[model samples]
Target: MVGVETSQHVQLSYEPAGVGDRVLAYLLDGFFMGVYFFVVFWIWGYWYSLGSDPADLSLSWVFYVVIVLPLMLYHLVSEVLWKGYSPGKKIVGIRVVKVDGSRADLSGYLIRWLFRLVEISMTSGVIAFVAVIMNGKGQRLGDMVGKTCVIKERKKAKLEDTLFKDVSEGYEPVFPQVTELNDKDIRVIQDVLDARSHYEYDTWFKMLKRTRQKLEARLGVQDHGMRTDVFLETIIKDYNAIHGSVK
Candidate 1:
């Protein structure tokens, strides 16, 4: 496990898979590619065996193109649309992201796919597999070209189980309100929390003021004097409280 302190509030932890998830993804992709390649090869061979001129043998490239197209397209679409995890990757709970902690884009995806040829050149992609295991960021040559890293999503810790392990239970906040907040506001708060280390006290103060203003505008509340940290904490506490009760 490699711990990257992305920010004071967001400690990004990399859960390294010991040759398990990678092997699984490789097996799944290999299975898909093998099936696809076999079908295309069979069709192409059949078409050629039907007395089609050997001079036109280059048409077999079409099958290769067809097979390659889906692989490229799937990666591009999944990275851009779903922020990384293709069906196989999602099933295995691994996702790719840029080194700077952003989602991969079209250029990055293309670079990744193009460089994958180098990674998989030798039999079984053992070189790439070794690179992933040895690299600090769990990145292969393709991932280096794409400036991406694979990471597993952190499992959500059960609050009740941890919180009550030491204390005798019945802890509650002083006030709870089921106030509505907009998605943009929520994203802003999350971003702020994620940027804690990059921001100074004055910068945080300014952001808090802006957040409060945005909250006031969105929620139509004229007076919300709670400090930004307190406000966020309260909202999360109330949400957990209500959510726990409902569950």
Candidate 2:
């Protein structure tokens, strides 16, 4: 799990996905691959048992190469272009990211795939599955080696309700003098207000406190006795009202 604390009214947090999800994903991938391999093996067996000349066995390697290359190409192309997610993973709503909270790059993807050989070679991936099950962060051998973790996609929050609630009820702004907020501060505020209803009360309160501190420091405004939540509600309402009128 990684905790991100913003110095504004935004509480963004995420947990690494558990082993059950990973196992299900693996089984899905395996099912697809199994069907593919069955067709390939059937063709190979038919070709080899034809009682052809021994020299024709040299051409059997060609069939093996043909069978393996497409699977490899599929992995290579999808991971590089889609940021560590294949079509299946995308459908499952899981994505891989680096430990530093960035998208997984080409190198990370390659490393993870390479390490997957070790995972596959150990008791038909039983060892790797167990490792993910036991690990605190739900990391398999490949994930540990690649320094990546799977995370669920977050739902986008609705901003209109949180930002304009009290304003629609005729609430007045208390901090009238604070101005010239930066883009980052504004974004943090937008995120916080948007997701206000999704988070716990304590989390919301902490975000409000941080936003108040940052706003006061940046604008050099003296703090009024108003509650942080009330101040935020008032400011967002004022902004929306002013901006809405201009449009």
Candidate 3:
């Protein structure tokens, strides 16, 4: 397990995916690619099947643009669109992340994708397997160069561990409706809140909006132009005030 300190200084632990799991994910991704190839071949003609030297100009150009280019960019496109999860990685419950539990930038993703040609395609994954096993952090050559690692998506900390704190003296509660949230709900809110700084702006905004909508529906309260992050922060403080540790 790797320990990461969030921007808030909260300690979070993530288990690195094993080499075996990564290999399985790779194979699964290959299977997805094979499916894609079969579909493209079926839709277009089997021009590249076995010694077919036909000269159909438009068909050939269409195939090259539709099939070849996308095939070449598949891994890169998938990771970016899904935020570090290829379809296979999403199914396997693992994802790419920076060492410090932050979202990796586009350059990092590109580096990893570029290295895939040598690490997996050229070497048949031998180099990647060895590197991932030798390093305890589940990093292949791509991950090392990209400064990222694959980690299991399971969160380690339980709600009981940090659900309540000592409410400061002279604190006024903003929303009595916060008590409508149970401990589990509080934990989910806290998790999203703590994780906000780790994501880039767009992702964080979407997440905040979703969480805020859900809370507003349940609590019968609207933000009324209040910032959503502040709404959640105030919820946590109000919860602490209601059911906090003894002073």
Q: Which one is best on lDDT?
A: 3
Which ten-residue region of model 2 has the weakest summed lDDT? 160-169
Error of 1 at 96 (Å): 1.1
**What pairs collide in candidate 1?**
none
TM-score for each candidate, following the candidate numbering: 0.56, 0.70, 0.62
Alpha-carbon error at 71 in model 3, in Å?
Answer: 1.5
Candidate 1, 38: how far from true, in Å? 2.7
lDDT of each: 0.61, 0.65, 0.79
Model 3, residue 34: what's the lDDT? 88
RMSD, one per candidate, in order: 7.8, 5.1, 11.7
Give the Å shift of residue 240 in candidate 2.
2.1
Provide the lDDT at 208 for model 3. 70
Show the lowest summed lDDT stretch of 10 residues, model 3. 5-14
| Residue 161's lDDT in candidate 1 | 34
lDDT of 2 at 27: 72
Of 1 and 2, the candidate ahead on TM-score is 2
After superposition on all CA atoms, how large is the RMSD of candidate 3?
A: 11.7
Clashes of each: 0, 0, 0
Highest TM-score model number: 2
* Model 1 segments more than 4 A misplaced: 1-9, 14-18, 41-61, 67-82, 155-173, 176-235, 239-245
